[model samples]
Target: MIFPKILRLDKAILATGIMAVLTASAVGTAEPQLPALPQAVSSFGATVCDGYLYVYGGHAGKTHSYDTRSVLGSFHRLKLSAPERWEELPGGPIAQGLNLVSHKGKVYRVGGMQPRNAPGEAADNHSLAEAARFDPVKRQWEELPPLPAGRSSHDVVVARDLLVVVGGWQLRGRSHMPLWHESTLVADLKEQPWKWQAIPQPFRRRALAAAAIGQKVYVVGGLSPDGPEPRLDILDLARRQWSRGPDLPGKERAAFAPAACVLNGQLIVATNEGVLYRLLPEGKEWEKVGQASRKRQVARLLPWDEHAVLLLGGAGGGQNHDSLEIIPIPPRPEPTPEAR
Candidate 1:
């Protein structure tokens, strides 16, 4: 993958000055400092449920190829406050690729492919429709109704109690097909007997990232048409409409997963390239928040109390990194009280 060149020092300096003035003035008076990214334990595709951070999937061991060939479906949860140590939640019967979402204190492990157990079976033969949910409190895994199609490399986001899944691709020998076009599943976890609804997008996409703001769900850049993927779409849940958001600021790339969360009523997104950004309502453009100390992917943001956020997991490449980083989600400045 080709990374875009870093901004020149002079350009960066000028940009910083402009950003400082714009951000402070826009948010209200005081200049809010972007929280410092904390030390991490390299890992990726982790989910934050309740107040704990749960990490699962991603590559393991030294050998890169081994990640796809030999990944462990182990789950670990970390308390956001106080005792910061990893506690194993539960392990699955098979290793899963990155695709996890949380709803109502439970984690839903969506579609992903694992290696075939037997020799005759092709390596790409592992497509799973079996949905699994982890009850963090009980530290147990229970199977749920399977998806319509077994797939991997898809993205899922929980919005308004509904788990919306998009993208996903299927492999046939060395080639693959769009998993998005066929059928999209939306599960309302709160409803009794849990029902799955089907929604369709104009095109097929895989490795796409998503986040919800109010009633709008932003489907950011992802891998489609094979090469680097670029195009950010939005689905308005309230109006049941699909529109577009600003394109990603950087180069187009795939295989990299994005972590998204709402901070102070604003949506913040982080990618594997260590780039961090925030999206405000101003023309739907993304503003660079800050960069992580190291390159990470599939990292999710978690609110630590009301003052900070944690970056969990080290995803992207075929390696398991056990890093947990934190940053302060500075409070929105208070407006000036009117003179009595």
Candidate 2:
């Protein structure tokens, strides 16, 4: 994929200064630093539910370096109100390239990629179709209906008890090739015996971000075989229709592994370039809301409160970060009265 060009020394210096000032204005005052992840990771599953932040399996090694010890199954959660520490929680398989979602008070984890080779051996990765839900009251994972087929690098969202999985590819290991998926998998969580139903998706892409606003699912950019894309596809559950929306704002680099979530009835997205944007109510354009202090790709963006979000655990500055940045949401621009 063609990413945005790296800034030169002079431009980098100027940008850093502006970022500091903007971050200061956004923060407003000194606040206690929140807890960081127990380890630096990326491509993990993360979400917020019932005043707690939960994270699950992620990649812990260098780029393209995978092993038994490197891919982590570790899971953790932080009580948002107390904000003192990240409590250890029950974890599942050594996997990556998935998303964690919250529905009611339970959190769900879907498909991901698992590596079976040793550190120095050739890659032997397998895409998984496993699905499970966590019970905070009992503190364990309960089995759920798995996907129809193996998939990974996809995103999941919970809306109206419907568990939706979208945009991932299937890894068939080193000897075989990977295949991009062209359909979306959905399961009704409230049903007694959960069964996955496949619905046709218009596009085939992985590493995309998915968010729900009302009954619609917004699919944002990711790397396609055609390379980086900024296209936005919207799925209306009511009509079961797929239509194009506004492209993501800023450089296409932002399109690759962008962070997205719903907050304050708005779809907020942050890019690898640190630019923050939101979908206007009209849904015709994306507005520049603000930016992040640290720019990271594939970070988890989840609602922290009514006015802020937690951007957690992604690769940045050539290294993985364990830091969690609190980004304050900017108010929408007032609508201009039409001139008569």
Candidate 3:
């Protein structure tokens, strides 16, 4: 995670944030005040379902500092339509470096890393292979099929009827280095018995983001073995084929742990440097759409409504933030009469 130009970017985003607020006000677009999270965290899991934002476990301690108390198991949700407090919910194990996805009315949690040792003790974090789903009606989590092996630092998405787990690594223990995952996992949420199927992946990466547009799951940039990569790998569920899309904006250190989501039938990605780009519908190129007022990494980028997307709970300027920033999707200019 290389955060370049920290001080300069902080000032830039501060000025930009104010401008965005003023502009949104002048345009008469009714924007809701995004409520802050109860606690600041990073490497957490978040998903939006039925107009509510749900947050799960994350790393609460300082960077490079790990302990039993540092990793969290707290679960919370907020109503987006009405700005209010984060209602506490039933939480699972203390975990980090995983992602959450929403399906129907349920929220699912996938594999994550759990620390086994206590504070001041030698690090003994182990990756988990378990998966669970929270049912709103029942108000309880129902366990589902586990991964073939433990995985963490991965992103998950629901493509059609399938739940796909993207790039991540398996943390064995303190004595063993994390093993990067070389395959993608898929499970059918609609299947009577949830079963995980494995498919070969071209490379092993971690801290990436994934989203499904139509039936294709786009696995975006993250930290790779060679270093920070901007490659965009697309898995066409309809065809069961893998192909490459345009890489993210920058060449190196541009998109480590970046976040992405689908907006208005289009794909939008926000890199670590705060640049928000939209993938052209043709799937052959990318166009810069906007820049984030708050530059962050490893956060959840969720579509707020039809107009804007919310950037929530990520680390920026050397620390994790609970603040939420609303990034409005820039509307395309009306086509020229002659061109049309």
Question: What's the TM-score of each model vs. the native?
Answer: 0.75, 0.89, 0.89
Q: After superposition, how far is residue 207 of candidate 3 from its true place, in Å?
A: 0.6
Q: Which stretches of candidate 3 lie over 4 Å from their true place?
A: 1-28, 333-340
Count of clashes in candidate 1: 14
Q: What C-alpha lDDT, on a 0 to 100 scale, does residue 263 get in candidate 2?
A: 79
Please give the TM-score that candidate 2 achieves against the real structure: 0.89
lDDT of each: 0.61, 0.85, 0.86
lDDT (10s digit) by residue, model 1, range 288-330: 7666666666456654444445676555455545555655444
- Residue-wise lDDT of candidate 2 within 74-95, one digit each (tens)? 8999887788998998898999
Error in Å for residue 318 of model 1:
7.5
Highest lDDT model number: 3
Report clashes for each candidate as comma-separated counts. Answer: 14, 0, 0
